[model samples]
Target chain A: MTFLDFAWPSFLAPGRLWLLAVPPLLLAAYIFLARRKSKQGMRYTNTGVLQAVVPPQSQWLRHVTVGLALVSLVALALAWARPFGTDKVPRERATIVIVLDVSYSMEAVDVAPSRLAAAKQAAVDFVNQLPASYNVALVSMSGSSSGRVPPVTDHNIIVRAIEALETQPSTDVGQALEQAMAELDQAPAGEDGDPPPGLVVMLSDAAGTTNPDKSPRQAAKEMGDRGVPIYALVFGTDNGYVDIDDVRYPVPPDFSFFSDLAALTGGQAYAADDASRLADACQKVGSEIGYVEVDKEVTATAAGLGLAFAFVAAVGAVMMGARWR
Target chain B: MAQPAFASPAAAVSSVVTEPSGATIPLSRLAPEAALRRLELTIVRRLEGFLQGDHLGLLPGPGSDSSDARVYNPGQDDVRRMDWAVTARTTIPHVRDTVADRELEVWALLDATPSMNWGTGGVTKRDLGIAAIATVGFLSQQMGDRFGGLIMRPAGLRRLPARSGRTALYGLLRSMLAEPIVPDGTKGPMDLPQGVAQMARSQRRRGLRVVVSDFLTPGDAELDPAHAPAWERSLRRLAVRNQVICVETVDRHEIDFPDVGEILIRDPESDFERYVNTSDEAARLRMNAASAAQRERIRIAIRRSGCGHIQLRTDRDWVQDIARFVLAYRRVAGRLHAPPRGVSR
Candidate 1:
């Protein structure tokens, strides 16, 4: 985000914002009173002679203290409105699931080494980039899907799970996502009644399987209904080839299917020839994934600032020794 | 001839009079009796001892009876008063001297205009003017001479008829002290010269006429010689018949501007206001020069009119200055058989 990008989640009482205009009005009145006071000071009998003896001094400097006090009052008014801004604070009590496809087709050597190897490496890189407070879970899917690592905060366990994945018969993206969600549900609940925000990141070479019982779209619908986003990455090119049982076969990647699945789950879809694009997507997801609007009271802070300004103004007035009638 | 014994025991009093304190006693704030007591203590007692002898003896007199024959000293005795009978008998030059006439009248013309209300010193010019009047009045009372005065205020002229005794002198002094002084409220310029001229016409008696003022008149004798100041002309007319003494009162602020950065000055008599920069050296010098020139003009006018000139300052020991002047006049008078040259009586 740019420097000016910020959010105010909630204002307890936003109606008090109208009071912000009062400082300028009070400043005008203060200026008038100060000028009048200067004019109406002691009346001398021999002003002619007195004028010869003493002249007027600069009055602009005298108003500085009052100006500070007015500004503080404005700040106090803002604090009274109870503003809460969305700050880029550290992510806490969050769970992120990384789903990897270990099907035979993922072994196509189109994206340097093989698609499966590239996915494994991207998964490890994604887990490493996440905030340490986040609990990461690993799930592998082929003919059947299973949770390799339950939701855990240790980076070594998640990395080991990604490295241990082996090639299986076929791809089942829906089962893999369902397994990741099931692991997130089984994980320990946070201090709040509800579980922490959950995210499912699936890395695969979208090769359609003839398994009608488990539909990827239906699975994405379920995750979406649970307010979870499924970020899908297609990791192979159209010119990819795979060898099965000593026979080489051309297995092209279907980017449209994975893109459709990510759209159904309110998430993004990415196509990467190597691990660089996947790594960038992982960093974006880590930064943008989970943020809860928490009410932070700023009344005391603003009032303290206002009081500080008031103290300065008071000290200045005393030092100047102006007649305050 | 033997000099007249004008000495009194009161002459032994210290000539070095202490300067008046800066604290001013506002007469309006005090009761009449209290104010009179303050004036008596502050001004009268200090002057009474030093100036207790005959007031008329300070000036040359025309006596109806001859008193004594004296050897005439050139330039010291008047040629018009040469005694032929004494000269024919003594061979040496002889001049007949006459004792000063009694029943002398002392008239004081006090300028209580709005300008007198201002002073940066301990006392204002008005306060000093009253003190001077008190000194002169008490001295006249001591000499058993009739005392009277004319006060020129911003409102109008006030005249006090000639009267004798201490009570009358105190009453006149109280009136002078009680005159109201308004700040920047005078409607128009005060006609001080006119008032002096009027006073001169009214008090035509051959006596001492003392004029006490700050002398900040608009008329310039050197710049406008054709139309000499009315006061100067009045002084000349008054000097023709009376011993005129001009007690010019001044304040230190009038002589030099203080180093105040800037100021708005308002003329009390004319109600005119002007902004000034006192910190500017050139401006300050210009103001000082103008003040000095104005003072010199007034001095020249008084001197040209052949009157006794005494300057009293608000910041200095005015009583001491007056005493010194009176003593010096007495010493000069004792040395010469006639009044000092150019001095009018």
Candidate 2:
């Protein structure tokens, strides 16, 4: 997401948002009073003497303090409206399938220490952050896809399997999803005979050639139908390249394809062009897939901010009041 | 001439600073009677010799009242003054003579304009002026000398008739202190020059004349030392006949600019107002230069007019300043009060 992007919140008590009108009115009144107090309306025995004596100093600090105070009031008014923002909460139980690309292009050196090694480390970190009760599996994708570790409550086995992965010949992302879906099918049901929620996190360098029988899109759609969402993390810059048969071939991740795949599976897409970004992307994907969305009240935070701003304004006034007089 | 004597510091009491509009302030608050009992204001100009009271005048004269018998000249003396009793006892012609008494009539013209109402140093300029008047009055008033006052406002001038004794002097001071403050922007035909000219035209006989004011003309922005003040000519004319002492009253802040950030400075007697940024050192220097120039111009004008000038500051001790001025004045009074070139003393 770009720096300016924000998730706008919905309010429970929308009618109370009208209280936001108070700050502007107060600002107008302050301006009027400041103008009236500018020495023209006040009486001095001799203005001629004062003209020779007093020089004007910048009152910008005073204005800044007042502005802060006004912002605090706005925050308080927003809290009064009982606004709600989307937040992630830890899931009680879930099954996650990690699909790692072991294609020859994953050996590109654009992401430091090679793309595969960085992706393997990020996947291990991602798995370790999940709840202990969740079942995690690992799948390797190349010319043909196959499961490395079956779905299990203990995530250490999958982390070790990811560390042992090596680059293979061709890349087939559709086959990787099929393999990931087969691993999720093996997840055990709860004592009440209900299957736990399932999520698929895939880290790939690029979208590869697909078979006519199972396209990547068709596989993602089928996974969506089965209540499983795919979170795709792309890890390669456009300048990424690898040498095969003494000839270099560029291997940039197809970000748009992965985004479309994630959309089709009712999930989100993330892109990272470097090792640090790949680590951050892994953490983001882990948090997004491992938690459920819920509404939360943030009134206390707003009120606390309002109180802090008010205290600053009061302290500033006390310190600068002598000069004003 | 004997030097003016000052009372001991222990004998003098501190004066209270009161607002000009405060009518309840006693006369003694400005200048105590005991502090001035020993002090005297020397009158340098030769006054008209007359036996109006027991006080000695600058010049002794012959009077119509009878006195000691003396030998009379045949053509220069009055023949009706022959004393037969003294002639019969000494077998010679004698005449009866009379003693003449000189009474010093002091008229103090107090400027009570709006500018005098300002003071950042506890006492207002108006009250300081009144205090000056009281000091001068107490020093000059004796058994027969009369003390009087003229209050000059923007609209007109009010006069308090000259009267003798200490009680009359107190009454005059009380009247001056009780004068209503002239609100700012009050317009009239009268000003400092006009008021001085009026005092000169009306009080023809003068012994000592004191002009107490801030001497800040409402719209006179001229600061050149060569250019005399608007009232300088009138003061010179008045000095032509009487000894004029110009007591210029000022506040401390008027001369020393304080470093208050930005403030709107305005004139009370005029509509001139401007915003000033005092934080700039250069701006403050410019303002201080202008104020010093203005005060220097006043000093030069007063000197050119040949008047005895003394400046009283609201921040300083007025009594001590007046005392020091009086002591120094004794030496220069003869030179300052010299008659015009065409006239003889």
| Sliding window of 10 residues with minimal summed lDDT for model 1 chain A | A37-46
Candidate 1, B296: how far from true, in Å? 1.7
Best by DockQ: 2
Clashing pairs in model 2?
A47-B265, A47-B266, A48-B266, A54-B278, A55-B261, A55-B262, A55-B277, A55-B278, A56-B262, A56-B277
lDDT of 1 by residue, B25-87 (tens): 443321233323323211110011112244334323455446678899999889988998889
Cα error, residue A276 of model 2, in Å, equals 5.8
TM-score of chain A of each: 0.66, 0.74
Per-prediction TM-score: 0.41, 0.59
Separately for all candidates shown, the number of backbone clashes (residues 3 or more apart, or on different chains) is: 7, 10
Candidate 1: list runs displaced more than 4 Å.
Answer: A1-325, B1-23, B26-100, B188-190, B218-230, B331-345
lDDT of 1 at B118: 59
Candidate 2 per-residue lDDT, tens place, B55-169, comes to 4334335644465788877998788778888988998888877755577888999998777777655566777788889899889866678888999988999999999888888
lDDT of 2 by residue, A1-325 (tens): 6867877578889999999999999999889877662244223443454443444445776797898889889988988988887666888888899999999999999899999989998898898888899999999988888999989988889888998998888878878899998998899998878878899999997888445246889899999999898898998999999999999998988999999999998998999998899889888887777679878977777788888888888877776565433
